[model samples]
Target: MGGTFDPIHNGHLVAASEVADEFSLDEVVFVPTGQPWQKDEVDVSPAEDRYLMTVIATASNPRFHVSRADIDRKGPTYTIDTLRDLREAYGPDTDLYFITGADALEKILSWKDADEIFALAHFVGVTRPGYELSAAHLPADTVSLVQVPAMAISSTDCRARVAQGKPVWYLVPDGVVQYIAKRSLYR
Candidate 1:
């Protein structure tokens, strides 16, 4: 469940919870990306703010918790590194699952050290509308599919709607929306 989590939203929670429930996972970790390789060309919201919002968004769910591994890492965050660190922290036998957007999974071949990631833990892809991932090109066979409802809403969309003074209440949790407003995240 590692992501930039620019601001945690319903899609993320729903997909993660669905996966946890489906697989009976012990806990779901919400990892905030330190510095996303994909976002190297643009400015991202600060890690501290993203982490705080993630904490606030998941506070009500006992099954969900935030991980600071990615945030604390000094270099560009890699999924393999994050997964390795998590495996070490949770012990070797822990049944860990990494949830990601299906679109990202489609581009796994381009990721660095992608082969090692397949051996790390299970990958749960959250399918949404439009972009469908090709299972044929998976980084590894460890990739498991869990088709959660397409939450058409994305962080970028939410941010844009917020910047335009549009109502974002329906796209994310109310508390999370409030946190964004209080912090002026998109504005």
Candidate 2:
């Protein structure tokens, strides 16, 4: 399971947990992307902050862990490269699952080394409102949909809520929200 995970919100946790539970996964290693490719269109919270928040958010879950592979790579975090490195690191015997959102699946064809990514690990797509998985350009038959609570609260929305002095309690883990506040992030 991997993403830029700018602030590790509730939606990400729920979706990842649902997938892991459904598949009876051993553990869900949350991988944070270093330099996200889509960052050209949007600003992310600092990588260190995002990584720290993820660590705080998933602390209670014994099945959840964080991977700094992409962050350590220190360049544009390519999904294929992460998958490849994880594949090697975890060894051939380990079953690897790559989790992402439905909108991403819709545009999976455009990713660098898209075909190899599908060949590498099982893919799980999480859908929220305004995004649906159609039969269009989905990678072969490797991608499967896992339905969880469609959290409308995105990290961006939560940040805006914080900036506006509105409550962000329901958007992310309490610890994460507090960390964001303590750091004066998204201000």
Candidate 3:
């Protein structure tokens, strides 16, 4: 699963778990975008902070792992590059699944190397709160739309809450809350 993962909230964890269970996936690697090209309009937390938050959030899950490929790589992050790097690392035989929210999947055509995306991995679009999931427009063979338990929490909301001096306790992992406080992120 690839995302900015600004704070790596519970919604992300639920989606990844639901998909992993439904698809019988061996493992789910969380790839936090280094420099999200699309989100460049807004100020994003440092790459290292986002990466560490992701690691803290996924630390307890045996099947969950964090990859710094996007953070380690210089320049703006494109979805194609992340998928290609994962494919290269995992090799040809291993079936790769690129898990993302339904909203992100809707913009697939506008992405760089759109056609080549499917060649690298199977795209799994998980239901996200407030986003209507419709795969009717997408190629059925390439994209699989699955419904996961809905959680209203989002990294954007979490950040706002922290900025307002409100609690984000259960919305994110305990370690994430501590890490954010320690780093004075979103303040």
Candidate 4:
């Protein structure tokens, strides 16, 4: 699973958990992007902050882990590069699945090295609130559409809540809530 995860939330955890269960995945590694190219217009939180929040969010799950591959890489983060790095780390035979929100999956064709991305890993498009889960436009063989519990929560919303001095409890993990407060993020 790859996302900016500015303040890793419960929705993200739920989606990962559901996907892991449905696919019988041995582990789910949450990879936070270093500098999201597609979201350049937005003032994203520091990569270290996002990475740490992700770590706090997934720390309790034995099957969950965090990676710094994207953060460690220089320049704009792209899905293709992330997939390639994972492929190298896991070896040639290990089946790699790139889990992402359905909305993001819809824009897969526009991503850098789009075609090559499919070769690196199978794509899993999980359901997100307000986003339709459809594989009509994607390669049927390399993509799988899974309907996860609809999670209306979003990082944008969480950030807004924090900036507005509103509580973000339950929207994100407890550790993340504390981390955001401790770091004074999104203020």
Instruction: Give lDDT: candidate 3, residue 99.
Output: 96
Q: Candidate 2 overall Cα lDDT vs. reference?
A: 0.85
The best candidate in terms of lDDT: 3
Off by over 4 Å in 3: none
In the range 90-134, model 4's lDDT, one tens digit per residue, is 889889999999889989999989988898888998888888766
Q: How far off is residue 91 in model 1, in Å?
A: 0.7
lDDT of 2 by residue, 1-187 (tens): 7777778898999999999989999999999889887766878878899899999999999999998899889779888999998999999999888998887777778889988888899888888777867845675578888888877757778878888999888789999889988999988
TM-score of each: 0.95, 0.95, 0.98, 0.97
> 9-42, model 1: which lDDT tens digit per residue?
8899999989998999989999999988888896
Candidate 1 off by > 4 Å: none
Q: Kindly give the number of clashing pairs for every candidate.
A: 0, 0, 0, 0
- Residue 23 C-alpha lDDT in model 2: 93
Give me candidate 1's TM-score against the actual structure: 0.95
Report the candidate with higher lDDT, 1 versus 3. 3
Q: Please report, as a residue range, the 10-residue window in candidate 1 with the lowest summed lDDT.
A: 132-141
Candidate 2 segments exceeding 4 Å error:
none
What does the lDDT come to for candidate 3? 0.92
